[model samples]
Target: MNKVEMHHTIMAAKARKEMTWDHLSELVRKAPVWLASVCYGMNSASPDVAARICEVLELGEDVAIAMTEFPVKSWEKTVPQDPLIYRLYEVVGVYGPTLKDVIQEKFGDGIMSAIDFSMHVEKIEDPKGDRVLLTLNGKFLPYRSW
Candidate 1:
C-alpha cells in the first residue's frame, strides 16, 4: 500500500483501538508530536519505530516501509479556510514581521529550525474558559557568510 493508504490504516487502527498519539509514542519511545507527524505522513520514521507502529496498529510491512520513506511536506497553497487554522494564519501574517525583527535583533541574523523543533499543547484554566496554549521550541540556526 502507498503512504496515503498507510496513513489511513494508521488512523483507522488508532480509532479502532482508541489509541492516542501520546500512548503510541510511549510504546514506540518517541516524542508524541514526531510520532503523530509520522502517522500523518508528514515525517519519516526509523525502521525500528516504523516496525513498532506496524505491530501496534496491526498493519503490515508495507506500511512500515512506507513510514520509512521520505515525505514531501506540502499543504494547500491558499490560506486555510478552517477557523482555527485560519486564526493561526492570521496571527502569523500580523506578527510574523515583528517576531522576525525582534528575533533578529536579540539573537542576530538567524532563523528557528523546524527540523530541530519541539512543541507542546497545554490547557490553562480560567474563570471564563479554558485556554489552549501552544508552545514551540526550536533550535536557532545562525547564518554564515561564506
Candidate 2:
C-alpha cells in the first residue's frame, strides 16, 4: 500500500474536486456516466467528445488522444491506466470506510465480493510487531451484475 502513494492521492483528489458531473458530461458532450463509460472503453468518444473533454478537464491534447483512442482489453473486467486507477486509490484511501458504510447500508449483506479478486500480500516480522502488508485492488461491480 505504501500509504497509497501521495502522487496518486493528489491526482484523484484533483479530479474529484475539479471535475463535476456537468463538466464531465459537457466535456464528453454526453451524460456524466458517459464519461465513465468512455473512460471504461465501453464505447468510443468522437473527436467532438474528445475536444470538449480536453477543454473542460484541461487535459492536454496528447492525453486527450490517449483517452479517445483508449485500448479495449478483452479481460472479463476492465481497468484504467495506472495513474487513473491510482487516483481511485487515493479516493478510497481518503473515503474508504465512508464508502464501505454507505455501500453496506444500501446493499445489505452484499459487500463487494472478492471472488475473482487478486491481491498481493507480504509478511514482515519485526521486534515491534509482525506485520502483514498488503496491496489489495480489484474491479468493483455488483456480483450479480457479473
Candidate 3:
C-alpha cells in the first residue's frame, strides 16, 4: 500500500486496538509526537522503529516498509480553523517575533533548526485544571555569510 493508505490503516488499527500514541511510542522506542507524526505520514521511521511499531500494532511488513519511506510534509491551510491548532497559530502570530528577537539576542542571527528538533508534551497537574506543557528543543543555526 502507499504511504497515505498505510497511514489510514495504521490509524484504523490503532483505534481498533484502543491504543494511545504514548503507548505506541513506548513500544516503538520513539518520542510520542514523532511516532504520531510518523503514523500521520508527516515523518519517516527508521527500520528498527518501523519493525517495533508493526509488531506492536500487528501490522504487516508492507505497512512497516511504508513507514520507513520518506514523507512529503504538506499542509493546505495557512490559517488553521481547528480551535486547538488555531490556538497554536495564534500563539506563533503573537509571540513569534518576540521569540525570534530573544533567540537572536542570545544565539546571534540564528534560527532554530526544525530539521534537528525534538519536542515533548507533558501534563502538569493543577487545582484549576491540568496544564499542557510543550517543550521544543532544536539546534540553533547561525547564519553564515560567504
lDDT of 2 by residue, 49-112 (tens): 7667656655556545555564444443344458956676677778998978887777653556
Deviating ranges (above 4 Å) for candidate 1: none
Tens-place lDDT digits, model 1, residues 1-146: 66799889899999999998888888888888789989989999989999999898888999999999999998888999999989999999999999999989989999999999998777899999999998989899999999
**lDDT values for all models:** 0.91, 0.57, 0.92
Off by over 4 Å in 2: 1-17, 26-28, 76-146
What does each candidate score in C-alpha RMSD? 1.3, 14.0, 1.0
Model 3: per-residue lDDT, tens digit, 1-146? 78889989999999999999898888788899989999888999889988899899999999999999988888876789899999999999999999999999999998999899999999999999999999999999999999
Model 3 clash pairs are none
lDDT of 1 at 110: 98
- Rank the candidate models, highest TM-score first: 3, 1, 2
Give candidate 2's error at residue 46 in angstroms: 1.0
**Candidate 1 or 2, higher TM-score?**
1
